[model samples]
Target: DTAVSQTPKYLVTQMGNDKSIKCEQNLGHDTMYWYKQDSKKFLKIMFSYNNKELIINETVPNRFSPKSPDKAHLNLHINSLELGDSAVYFCASSHLQTQSPSSNYGYTFGSGTRLTVV
Candidate 1:
């Protein structure tokens, strides 16, 4: 079974539209995250949900929101989308534990949803 999964792997929308992407993980992890990959392939985490608590990156715009209905899911919602928002969004999950060489619990990322705004 897939450890992590996302729906609607591709999205094409017009400016000023609203959209949402759903993500679910079966790794039994306590922490899940949303990362945005720009056209340059630069990855930057936007929001993180730890055990259903939302922790958003300060740099992220208020228009973007992360909703964790449960520990195994983190869904992203974008309102009044803009062209600048066009990018590949990735959903990832990781064990909620201290990281060490012997206890490394790395992140498992979804296939990614490529969003385009015209």
Candidate 2:
């Protein structure tokens, strides 16, 4: 079983289409998040969910949406995708209650789902 997993390691689509990426974590962590790595390799938080509470970063677009069916999974669904939406999407998780050292506080990311829109 993987600690964190995301499906469709690579995705190529046309602009204005809609698609989704699924994520799951078996680490029993209470906190989970989605991050986007742009072409420039800049990592930015898109959404964070902890104990059923959703914390969204300010920079995310309305076209991007995140949903958590339960504590074990978080999925990303995009509507009217744009060329700019093409990027590497990563799913990660960490222990919420047990705070780890700075080193341990690092995210355990999925292999990454690469999205390319033409």
Candidate 3:
């Protein structure tokens, strides 16, 4: 079974439109997050959710939002899409645990959704 999955592996659209990406995990993880990879392949956290509780990155724009209906899922919604938003969006999850390599708990990222705003 897949640990994590995301929809719309690729998205291409014009600017000024609103779009959303869906994510779900079956690993029974409590924490889920949305990460963005820019053209330079630099990854940055955008939002994190645990049981519907939202923790957003300070550098994330207000136009980006994450919604989690349950602990198993977290989705991202972007409003007024801009060209700068063009990047690969990844959804990931990790079980809640202390910082320890023996925990067997680490982030499992989805294949990613590539969004292109022209």
Candidate 4:
């Protein structure tokens, strides 16, 4: 069984369009994150939500939003998609240790969603 999963494995849209990627984790993790991997394969953290609360909001554009309806779900919404937004978006979940914030367990990543904006 897949620990983490994302819908619309491949998305192709035109510029100025809007898209949303749905993610879910069955591992019962409290923390979930959204990462974007560019064509060069450089992964950048876009957002992180812990227990339905926004925790880490990287320097991503305001057009990009992360919404967590519950501890097991984290979704990414992109507004006015641009060509530069073409990349693979990965959804990952990890068990965050409150006692030691840095001591987080390994993350389980979903099969990335490849977004192509023309």
Best of the candidates, TM-score? 1
Q: lDDT of model 4 at residue 74?
A: 93
Residue 114 in model 3: lDDT: 100
Question: What TM-score does each of the candidates earn?
Answer: 0.93, 0.90, 0.92, 0.92
Q: How would you encode candidate 2's per-residue C-alpha lDDT over 27-59 as one tens digit per residue?
A: 888889999999999999999888757889998
Model 3 spans with C-alpha error above 4 angstroms: 97-104
Runs off by more than 4 Å, candidate 4: 97-103
**Residues 1-118 of candidate 3: C-alpha lDDT, one tens digit per residue:** 8889999899998999999999999998899999999999999989878864678899999999888888888889999999999999999999875567698576999999999999
Q: What is candidate 2's TM-score against the reference?
A: 0.90
TM-score: model 3 vs. ground truth: 0.92
Q: lDDT value for candidate 1?
A: 0.92
Clashing pairs in 3: none
lDDT of each: 0.92, 0.90, 0.91, 0.91
In order, what is each prediction's RMSD in angstroms? 1.5, 2.2, 1.6, 1.7
The all-Cα superposition gives candidate 4 an RMSD in Å to the true structure of 1.7
Which 10 consecutive positions of candidate 1 have the poorest summed lDDT? 96-105
- Per-residue lDDT value at 67 in model 2: 86
Candidate 2 lowest-lDDT run of ten: 97-106
Pairs of colliding residues, candidate 2: none
Please state the error at residue 106 of candidate 2 in Å. Answer: 2.9
Candidate 2 vs candidate 4: the lDDT winner is 4
